[model samples]
Target chain A: MAAQTKPVLHGYFRSSCSWRVRIAFALKGIEFEQVPVNLIKDGGQQLTEQYKALNPMQQVPAVEIDGITLSQSLAVIQYIDETRPGPRLLPGDPKARAQVRMISDLIASGVQPLQNLYVLQKIGAEKLQWAQHFIDRGFQALEPILKQTSGKYCVGDEISMADICLVPQVYNAERFKVDLRQYPTIKRLNKTLLEIEAFKVSHPSQQPDTPADLRA
Target chain B: MAAQTKPVLHGYFRSSCSWRVRIAFALKGIEFEQVPVNLIKDGGQQLTEQYKALNPMQQVPAVEIDGITLSQSLAVIQYIDETRPGPRLLPGDPKARAQVRMISDLIASGVQPLQNLYVLQKIGAEKLQWAQHFIDRGFQALEPILKQTSGKYCVGDEISMADICLVPQVYNAERFKVDLRQYPTIKRLNKTLLEIEAFKVSHPSQQPDTPADLRA
Candidate 1:
């Protein structure tokens, strides 16, 4: 794995899940070749036969490196962290690593999956309402943990994988017009997170992989 | 922390989530005292003043140990694993830890959040449809990963946190009328998981925390 040898990220530009992985890679400052898989414009480029071969479940953000294709955003990021040493995303201690993993799970398993874009797309007639409903619930569930656990960052000042999960979920919240004022801790964390160059360069607007028309 | 000492678990008997923690405690052969924070019949006692003091969010499965109170199921479980060394719930390697966390997430974040009792209670006339829809989507998301990684257990031979997340989500699926026949891997995993005495004792039906009405 040479520094110049970037991994191929099979993902879409607007997907919030994809944004999470993008932020992790940027935070770690790893170079990756973007293999854009448009989720909507082409009826989901992720549904193609070739993509299915890469991920049998047909999901986005599958990464290919060293001839090994890996699925799942968190797993891919952890693999990158293990293979390459940089800014540590997890605590060196086992208990702290578990804490980081727990915080990451609160977003990954708790908040993010509920208001997922596909779920938004699947709910047709009252799509907007259902999407907003889940978004509100996810924000509500996540707020408590954010209040108690965060200190400058998600789990203290040093950035960990949990921060990576939080940034994209917060971005999704803003995208859907979910007022995050109620969650003061979240707002503060997001504010500070936005100040970091790692989150800035990986912001959805800055990605070169996104379609020009979709780039707001 | 004596093995015979009574550890208090703040949970509702009717709460499937509480059952997960309870099962974990019992499976480890750790004796714990049960404190009922009735979530439903008592106007959600979990949301009462006492519980709010324990958990700002007022969710179940909060554990009080060594004069410290911790919320979030994964955090509580991790605390248990760190403080009490019994059968190791996690692997020793970082790569393996990542995989276990990823699989646990597939169940915890992907499956559990959607069918969470509170979420279902909030759903309207289209309840059954949404429940079944989400359960189907969760299983669809998990199948590929399960097919790829599962051995005698979710990862290889030993039971990890992944098993904890899986059993509860599968139980919730059946509660929502999601047919298990569609997911052969999950069905097989559950079949094997149920055989373990720990899982059997942890079964919601067998828990003191499970309310009479909800008991199978």
Candidate 2:
């Protein structure tokens, strides 16, 4: 995908939530300028007064699109899928959409929120363990559901919003060193999703702002 | 609403998430049988093998609707609004729906997950403070957005899914003793939402399984 000035995305390279939006944009073939918000350097640029004015939550990737700045990764993904031209991220059938959303919400609210950086920070020295615990629990629940719904993608053969949500979360789970071998379905899906061009381009290492030492 | 056998909702009386669905059901005037899943007694009925078979996540409310059991509160709510006969829970315009979803996500992923009973149990002694901290942070972000979009509702007088997510969260906040005085917008919205029949009927205290002494 070529870079253009359609939307400005403020994000950190390693943030799973930010990566979710990046993957969506890549899949949609939408050109966006990446404005790196260094989450580590000088204590997170997202916390700055300027960024706070952009997003009161002080989270990333807050995107400037459709003449407004939007926050929350899932909402941003839905907005992009709705307003922009894309292979539809959500399924057309309401029941299929519900199934897709079920997986998406499983990750968004059930998995990612409990194990994100902010929650890890709050968990203190046991952050890694805390992350692994939640990821394992979420994956255990997700594996059975995915087994029921998945084909080549999370829901049937199509790459829907569920896949968009799943890949990044699996990235974070691996980062936390949560063993995926136990979750065969998730492991298989993650491996398959990582091979996709959209997922490849949106990888944290591939981000323009990814540090040299962290580059994969 | 007349009692009918369309959906069976397995939910705890006090769960904010379950309350969100209850409010949606009430607003949509869909009659669902409530099968109480006691989260406290017998070490949480949701953890039992039978309940886990129904919903591997072991969370309430696990709803049996449209011939399949659905878990995850947001997904269930979306499914209800989408598949059933009801007033629309989301807005018509894409941008409007995005705004509504943004607020809903802020509360769902940002506020509720961090402060839910499971996490509170994990937080141990400092659970109350942790709950208050997150609720305050979320309400701070929410107050401004609500200020922009709200007029008798979370988004321009129509009770979108954001309002469904909000009313129950405010209930949880008050339970945690989080001061709402600082968030006048949230406080006012909560007050107004409470007066509505749907929100009133869905209050935790009014649920069929709510303990008699706890009944309001």
Candidate 3:
């Protein structure tokens, strides 16, 4: 709660939601500590009572900041943007801001949740196929949207929260073997976004908890 | 686009996402026209090319307002709250706003998407079981958070976006047969919320396209 206390991000190395928060922090130049709650270790540490106390949803990337803990990456990102001085994660124009939220929600809700660890685990042996199916379907819808919305980034020339959402989801898409060529706008935007310092530092491979073998 | 032109909402009667937008409109005292994009009739009208153009995501509750169209119910709701003069759907304080968004995203992304029509159709014969599993999981997590956050609604006494999201999802939970008694906070909030005119007018059973048998 003290102003001098650094924010602590409790997250997993490869979780897309965690990566989103990392990108927001890096973009905002807000120094934060990492406390990895490995999703796969010891039958998922996130499910433990300790972590659940931090986030009743028991999800990764529960951030302790501004005197309270916040989960849901978008909420944390918006909080950072609201309280900190940096590039605006949401654009000034109401229409543009709405577009950004629309795109972010499409990926966050419509796409990512279907292929996430818990859902895929419940999907059993058909996990790969299941992930592939949903990712492909999502990207098919997303392609045209990005085509309509993108200008150097997911919204416009400025890097907004939509761009923050884009890179991680495209990473998940590739991991699931979703063909990127099918979504030219998304692929181009992801490529452009990855070149930024904020995105590079926050990437899954570069995280503090990223396994050595997977390090950039 | 004109100032005098009424906002038009393209949505299905029973879709939970659509219902969220409806509640927001009702709460704002904004009179809007409904252009029903029936999700089930004629093989999912939302999949049609015309609707896809309105919302590249091919989802419901795309609102045509202020010379632009917005998809994703939360995005539309936020835009309305920002542009209109009425009861604020999002509280003004930063932390409280983030909490509202967190709760909204928890349901919108984490729970509802898993058991939505498209997902359920893909889930085949196990759809009922799958819906129950995710709803139960989501409600279990939501209960404690609501207990922590709720005063008279999902956030505080104000009818924020989290409350807009809560009613529709609880309706879906009942349809899927999740036991309400287990989630006392959610049940209590939903009960109190349902008594409000905003929620009553926006109920699925009272929608313009609600089938006669299902009408309130």
Each model's C-alpha lDDT?
A: 0.74, 0.90, 0.91
Error of 3 at B216 (Å): 1.4
**Which one wins by lDDT: 1 or 2?**
2
Predicted chain A of candidate 3: TM-score: 0.97
Best by TM-score: 3
Candidate 3 positional error at A141, Å: 1.6
Preferred candidate (DockQ higher): 2 or 3: 3
> How do all the candidates rank in terms of lDDT, highest first?
3, 2, 1
Model 2 lDDT on a 0 to 1 scale: 0.90
Provide DockQ values for all models, in the order shown.
0.37, 0.78, 0.83
What global local distance difference test value does model 1 have? 0.74
Better of 2 and 3 by TM-score: 3
**Stronger candidate by lDDT (1 vs 3):** 3
Docking class of 3: high
| Ordered list by DockQ, greatest first | 3, 2, 1
Residue pairs clashing, model 3: none
Q: Which residue runs does candidate 3 get wrong by more than 4 Å? A: A1-3, B1-3
TM-score of 1: 0.86
Predicted structure 3, TM vs. truth:
0.98
